[model samples]
Target: MTNLLRWTTPDLALTFVLDDGPVRLIAVREASQPRGGEPDPSQPLVEVAAVGHGHSSNRHAGTVLGRQLRYARHDETETTLRIVQEELTTGLRVTSVFEARAGVRAWTEASIIGPGSLELTNLSSLVIGLASIDAELYSAANSWMAENRWSKRVLRDVLADIVRDPHHHVANSRHAVTGTNSWSTGETLPVGVLVDRSTPYALGWQIEHNGPWHYEFGENRRGGYLLLSGPTDHEHQWSVEITAGKPFTTVPVSLVVGTDVDSVFAALTRQRRAIRTRRPIDDRMPVVFNDFMNTLRGDPTTEKLLPLIDAAAEVGADYFCVDAGWYAEGDWWNTVGAWEPSTTRFPNGLAEVINRIHQHRMVPGIWLEPEVIGVRSPIADELPDDAFLTRHGKRVAENGRYLLDLRSPAARKHLDTTVDRLVDEFGIGFFKFDNNTMTGPGTDKGGTSLGHGLLEHNRALLSWLDAIQERHPDLLIENCASGAMRMDYAMLSRLHLQSTSDQEHPLLYAPISAAAPAAVLPEQAGNWAYPITGTTREEFTFALVNGIPGRLYLSGHLNRMTPAELDLVRSALTAHRAVLDDLHTLVPAWPLGLPMWTDDWIALALNGVDVSYLTLWHRAPGPSTITLPIPRSKIAPHFPTDLGDWTYAWNDDALVINANTPEPAARVLRLE
Candidate 1:
């Protein structure tokens, strides 16, 4: 006999199929949509793999344990459900938990109920059959400077039909996106979207892990399934020994269903806000001026900062951050972790610059890489080898620095002391925490596997962030791993801001800024807008436009700007502040469908109740006109307020814009 179970949230519906054999998740769709028939029977609710006992006949499926587990029981609450299954031969117990929100947040846990030890190589956090086999897949590729480069691919094109007969064979191949090492988003975002080609139905998911993660979609005998997981034995050298009394849990991931791409992303935006730890500082969404991008460039001195401080304050910056080189006397690359002000660089002291920032009615902030210690630093010698990540009794060193294992009390204490001293001595209110090193697999310091060891350290890092935030409730921290590499909810949930990129060129940053909202919340994406002193008026405005839609991370040598140019900078800030007023309530839409790196024109719309804010950028050097498909509404100039060489008109539901400038330019428009 077959048993069917169904669960519904306000927006999503999940259907499960249970038989005397293994359990399967067959359908996931909008609550209003009808549940379909049994999908691929091999679509297990949770996939697992053990050391000696692996897959039976489907080892070619890239999985080892999905078919061996059988249904045990299930329990449900008003908003949460837990389904338990067991591998009777090995006494392995698995529980799949789901919490209903606007969408569904789910994860899985595994434990052994008997005496025999089980070493796990693979365990999935989520495994469910997608609604359709044919869909448009959306994923992103990330890097140091160029982040959020999204690409669209048809599911069939990527995962070919290798099945000879639909009733006889299933394809073992999979289309996968994997992020290895410590930077969760170093290679690609932990987020993805799928929109059915024939219908408006769509699905989106995000893996909330700060370290390595793996997500793959593959077709079985009938349909397709998505599997999300953390470090695996094949991918990240991660495995754990599970005995009778020990249990292992995979990282948490969230899934949401919507109608179209925009609706799916909007639901994700709402889900991100729901999980974020609310703070007053984050709510205010203050404008920050960091002297790193194109101005100070990690060589800040008292002389270089005083003028910048005044300029940032005069242009309405709420915070002034002295990024990098603050604690170094000279070449600080291999001499970090002391966390003391450089006496030679500042002459008087770093406090002099911090105090000057305070005198200008702005919060003082400093940069620090809390997770790394310079190899040549004395502190490296003071801290025991156990305080850092290690493998085979040797420290894991990369790029002239050692990655701190936050699991160590000594390491956490060192960071606590550094942060406390900076706050107490310099009156710092914000911190820009950067991680520049990528620790390969992880440490085998303990008897655990390298992957398991790294997972523990990753959890320890999050706990440390929580502890410090509790101690300093008002302190704000910005998450930057070489810039947007660690851009995941695992960190963004706690940190106040995320530096979108380290890209210096304004034209290059346009696409990064426009496409960032697809993966990150607008309020948290800290895009850099550095208008050079000698650039043309159009060029300066183009730079500032990159920052307006999101949190305006202001930079540049504003003190040396001409009077007219200075006013323009101030004007950009004023325009940004207006956007901040409704930013938290707005949902983003890309009329241009997620900018391409080489796209000549880009548009981002933040939709609100009564008004919609639009940012239009034309990067080509010539006269051009593009029509944006927006409903006809009363439109007006917003940013420069002068329209310069731009003209606009309305054609039915489309808004037409002509950029007559021979140089690159951009503008912010409002529609009501």
Candidate 2:
């Protein structure tokens, strides 16, 4: 007899069945829907394989629909469920855990209970099979300065060729979207949505891993299946040897089902907050002013920073960060391992500049690239070979820097000392941890495969960060990999903020900022607002508008701006502070729809309970008015209310805002 177990949220439900075979996902639907009434049942909840010492021992496993197994035991909590099952012949126990809330978080653990060791290969965190035959897929293709570029495609486009009439023995081909190395989000986001065309149902999920991950969609006898996994042997040379007493667990993956994309995204937003290790600073989304963007450009001197610090504090900025090159002399990229105060840049020491920032009631912060040791730095020779990532006994160097293996005690100690010294010596309350280089596949040390070693190292890095947070409970950290190259939830779940982009052009950055909420939470999205001198008032408004809906990361030469430009900056800051408290409970939506790389106009709305904030930018010549999706309501200009030329009109079901000016203009509005 098949025993059925269930987990559900107010809007979603997931059902699993345990029988004399492997555990299988029976149904995933809205709370009011029936169980998997579909006919197909070959898909399993999780997939695993055991590669033994001999060829005869290899077993290819899929859905537990046909295989024979024995149910061991089960455990349950209000929000979580765990079930254990043992293979009939191999004695391998597979434990699957499911957590329910706004979404379902699930993962699989493999353990060998018998005497012999087992080689595990091709393990997936979760495999969700959809019975809907004509489903459309939605996923984002991300890259540097071009993050969160989403596209929608029909399942038939990718799986149609493999689904034949009635061959019975036809082979199934898989269409995979995979990413490699520590920059898990460098190529594509670890998220996807499968929506049925005929119905208002969709399944969305995010693979929560910071390192290499793989997700694929293929046609199965039971409609189609989606596989979410970590590093695999074929992609990352990854495999693990599980002993009798040890257990291996894959990274977590989240699943949510709803009637449409908006509802699914809303559930995901709640899931993101639920899984995060909350901190006090998250509640207070402070405005940060960094000297790197269009300002000092990382060449901060005591003389150059004093006026900027005053300007930043005058504008009500809460934190001031001294970006890169703060500790370097001239050519500092390759000699950046030893983070020390430069005698030339700071004649009175970096402490003097930081103290000035403190005098203005702003917290002092600095940038640190903690994962790499420069090739020319003395620390490269000071640390042992084991401290650095090695491939075949040779240190792996990329972009003139050697990647540090956080798994090494020596490397962890070094980073700990550096972070501690900065916090203790300078009263630093924030640190921007940036990674600029990628370490190919992974390391070959520690008696593990290259991909396995990288996985362990990534896990160790997270553990080290947890220790740091434990010591400094109030400290805030911003996760940046050359501006969001590693913007997966695995890192954002622990970090306080996410740097949205590195694109310097204010016009080009508008779309990136508008689309950021699709991948990151609104309060955590760090959008840069750098208004340079000599630009028009519209241009200044364009720059400031980018930061209004999210964390306003102020930049530009504010100290050199005229009184009018300065007032514009202060006005944006005032508006941002007014909405900071309300932003905590708001979820994001696209009214004019998701921005394209070359869209003429972009729109983003932070939808709150009774009120909402909307930001619109016109980048190219187009229609003077763009209709919004929200209903007709009272609308007011939120920022730069003094712009007398701009106007808006709300019809029955649409709010049309007209940008009286030409292209490269923006406005922030409050809708009720």
Candidate 3:
């Protein structure tokens, strides 16, 4: 007879089969739902692939070593569970740990004693067999200025049905999504959702790593399986030689279950909040005016900034950030590293401009790319060879910049001295840390694999960020990589805000802003709202509305705008501050499904306790009226207060918006 072991949380339940063979994780479902039938025996709790030993049957599943391991012991607590398995021959032990937080998080740990050596290529963080094969996949493609472009596809469309023969052999091919290099979201997001077509069952997961990660949905003999991992030798050239005393641990991942896309994303939003470090700056959600998007565009001089600083203060901005070029004398792109303020750009001195921002009762912030030292930078030659990432005794150079190895004491000291001197010299409270280059496969430093070496550098970078935050408790930092390339939990969980995109056009920016909440928290999504001085009223409001829903990242030339335009900007900030009152408790919902890049009509709603807020965008001229499936409530214009040409009413519990404007337009409505 087969023995069964079960664990239950308030919202989720897991069932495992403890047999003579390897421990099999059979079912994972809602606690209130019933276990349908017998557990599937093909699903192993842990899957590992090494250099010497491969799989027993298929290249993807049925690992021989994984099947040979047997359960040894288990332990559980109010919010954590640990299961241990051992292979008697190699004396290798694997421990699978699960934690119950806002959602379920899991990881794997391995150690060996008598085994001479094992070079591991692949190690799974979590694997579970699905109940059915009929499911839809939801994933997003990310890029420089265009981020979070999500698309949905049927499972059969990607995972082919090849079980036509009498043998019923499972295919090894998988619908995989992988991310490489230093930018976690440079190619694809580290999160996805699998929703069952026939039932309401939906599963969502996010791999929490600052480096490479892999996840796949494929089939085995019994049914479909979802595998989540960090890095693999085949994909990322990452491998670790595990000796007798040296053990390895996989990166962590979080899993959540819900009914549909909205619910699943809501749970994910909560999980993001649960993992984030609590800081007073994040809670305040202050309005930051960055003079880069459409105004200075990396050319900030004392003469150009004094007037903008006055305009930002007049409009009630809490933080004024002088973005790129502030520290550049001339042609500073490839000569960046010693972050001293440019004497030529500021004429009177950068401190005079920084002090002017302080005189206006706003925190002064500046931009810095701390990870890379330009090829021409003197610091690049000043630091020792070991201070930078090197392969074959040569430094790794990409896009005219040399990557810094934070693990080196020299590199850390250089960064520490630069940051401390700037903070003390100017009373700087904010930093927009930008990364523009990518490390191809990492560095093979210290006789480690390139992937493992990059992994160490990633962790070391996080440690450095932690140290800086500890030393400067009141300082706030923004995580940026060109745009949203590094927009993952590993950075979001620690940083104060995220730059959603560097897209300049407001019309093109609406879709990104609407879909960003699915990946980033509402208060942390730093959406840029740069209202041009010469645009029409509708065009100007369209840009301002883009920033009102998330972190109102104000930009554009307020000094050049007419008095009427500046009033509109002030009104948008007022509406954003009101939304921040309930932003933490509110969850995001798409009245229209996940937006398309060129969708004529888009709707994003932030559902709250007593009152909710909704933003509607009519991007094209053809669609005069669009119906939105939202709760029926009294609606009032939150921003501008003047409805201009747009009008709305309730049909049952759905919203019907009539775009009376002839041109493109957008608006934020308060629903109560």
Give the clashing pairs for model 3.
none
Q: Best candidate, lDDT-wise?
A: 1
lDDT of 1 by residue, 180-269 (tens): 999999999999998899877788999999999999888866567888888888789989988878899899998988888899999999
Clashes of each: 0, 2, 0
- Candidate 3: how large is its RMSD? 1.5
> Which ranges of candidate 1 are over 4 A from the true structure?
34-41, 56-64, 166-168
Candidate 2 ranges with C-alpha deviation above 4 Å: 1-3, 32-39, 52-71, 161-166, 642-644
Error of 1 at 384 (Å): 0.5
The residue-by-residue lDDT of candidate 3 on 1-672, one tens digit each, is 567888887767888888888887777777788766744747788888888777643334567678788999999987888999988776778899988877888999988868487888778898877766689999999998899999999987887788646667767768889999999999899999999998788999999999999988787666778888888887898988886689898989998889999999998988888889977756767899999999999998889999999999999999999999998877888899999998888788888999999999999999999999999999998999999999999999998999999999999999999999989999999999999999889989999889999988999999999999999989999999998999998888899999999999999999999999988999899999999999999999999999988888999999998999988988898899999898888889998999999899998998887988898889997449888888778779997687888877879877888999889999999889
lDDT of 1 at 284: 70
Residues 434-482, model 2: lDDT tens digits: 9999989999897888998899999999999999999998899999998
Which rank order by lDDT, best down to worst?
A: 1, 3, 2
Worst 10 residues of 2 by lDDT: 53-62
The lDDT of model 1 is 0.89
Least well predicted 10-residue stretch by lDDT in candidate 1: 56-65
The Cα local distance difference test for each model comes to: 0.89, 0.82, 0.88
Error of 1 at 9 (Å): 1.5
Q: Model 3 — which ten-residue stretch has the worst lDDT?
A: 55-64
